[model samples]
Target: MIAVLRTPRFLLRQPQLGDAELIARYLNDYDVAGNLARVPYPYHLSDAKAWLRTRVPGLPVEETNFSIELAGEGFAGHVGFHRGPQGPIIGYWLGKPFWGRGIMSEAVEASLDWFFSASAAPVVYSGVFHFNAASLAIQTKLGFTETGRSTLLCLARGAELEHIDTQLTRSVWKARHT
Candidate 1:
């Protein structure tokens, strides 16, 4: 079965058909989409539907995505890993209202613990837009170190931006947690 992870404040559950409206509502905000690479600026209901269709249940750890539902509230955002050519890449986004409350950090930590446990990957990768200080801090706090820099297309901004790439190896994660 696909896993549903729980943190003290949130539940990382699989994205469902019923979640499309909620996902669309939060992602429609430009501020929320601006920081993300793939999310479009005028995110629409159809986009949410397409995204939901892409989520394959029971896929390997690297191929899955999750809905970041608050303990009592509904969908706040999403966190997931995509299998890139080099390795598994982890990514996440939270609604603007949920920012500055350490929610993403908690949600990510819970997912990472599950990811690292389910896969034998030596390192997991993530990247942050140079201006997204909060995202960079989250990765750094979780022990991801700078791997390099790369330019990527930001659909929301309709341009290429330099991203700070970071990686966390199994050993680094273990050291930090233990």
Candidate 2:
């Protein structure tokens, strides 16, 4: 089973079939989808369903994803890690209604706490499109330092864009948390 992670404001659990609608609703917003490298624009329910079907629990920590839920709000966003060319990569997105509230920051922190405890990976990789200052700020606040830059395809934008790569060593994360 995928372990559920808790934060002061939200519960992070495995994404369920029922969450497909909200997932589609949130990602359909270009403002949200455009920031992500893999989500196509005009995200649809079927798309969400297809993606949800791919989320298998009990996998390695690096392959797991979580759905962020509130007491009454249901699904609010997602945070998790996956295998990347350089190493394990962490990624996330939040609904528009939940933006500018420090929610993602809290959620990412909790997720990282869980991640470091569960995996022995030396570092976690992350990055943001050059235009996503908010996400970059969150990464920086969490001890991720820029490693380099590269061009990555943004499915929503349908174009290649500059990506600012970052990495957080387990020691750095432990230093901040301790």
Candidate 3:
């Protein structure tokens, strides 16, 4: 599929109706599902469709929830932003098999670049389960700094959680201008 922005190895695009199974297989892994708050443990096709159907309030469907697609090695992961009280909240996840391959970092950098370009705001933010070293490393590689923290109450996981809050600012991006 044609994406709004295609990185050298990944494609940042809108979610398609038929991507249910593709989304489920990667996310349903217990190792993978534990890191994110929203994705269910079972990760059914219906769950994928329900998520895809969630549109931003008062905004059209196209403006929200962009999915990151990896085409070369397969559709390996997803990246997207959602509305937050402070600003836009960026999120992403790659299947465990794709970990350590530098795939998610490429996708995240591309997503941050796009977010900075599209918004008047000068920064992008991400949060991760503090224990997710891989995600923290990927965010660091993409120029995000650990600037804050929060607790996420995961009903599915059935616990209070501590998460690392990371941010990439326009100033940082400008400082590293390519």
Best by TM-score: 2
Clashes of each: 0, 0, 0
Residue-by-residue lDDT tens digits, candidate 1, 1-178: 6798988887899999999988888889988888899899799999999989988767888887878888667888889999877899999999887889999998888889999999999999998999999999999999999989999889999999999999999999988877
Q: What count of clashes does model 1 give?
A: 0
- From the highest TM-score down, the ranking of the candidates is 2, 1, 3
- Write model 3 residue lDDT over 1-178, tens digit each, in one string: 2237787877777776666677888787878888887776877778877776764244422244556666766567788877667677788888788888887778777766766776777777777888889888888877789888899865447677998888878898878777
lDDT of 2 at 166: 96
Model 3 segments more than 4 A misplaced:
1-3, 55-63
RMSD of 2: 0.7
Better of 1 and 3 by TM-score: 1
Off by over 4 Å in 2: none
User: What TM-score does model 2 achieve against the real structure?
Assistant: 0.98
State which candidate, 1 or 2, has the greater lDDT: 2
Candidate 3: residue 166 Cα off by (Å): 1.8
Candidates in order have lDDT scores of 0.90, 0.94, 0.74
Residue 20, candidate 2: alpha-carbon lDDT:
97
lDDT of 2 by residue, 62-177 (tens): 99898999878788999989999878999999999999989899989999999999999999999999999999999999999999999999999999999999999999999996
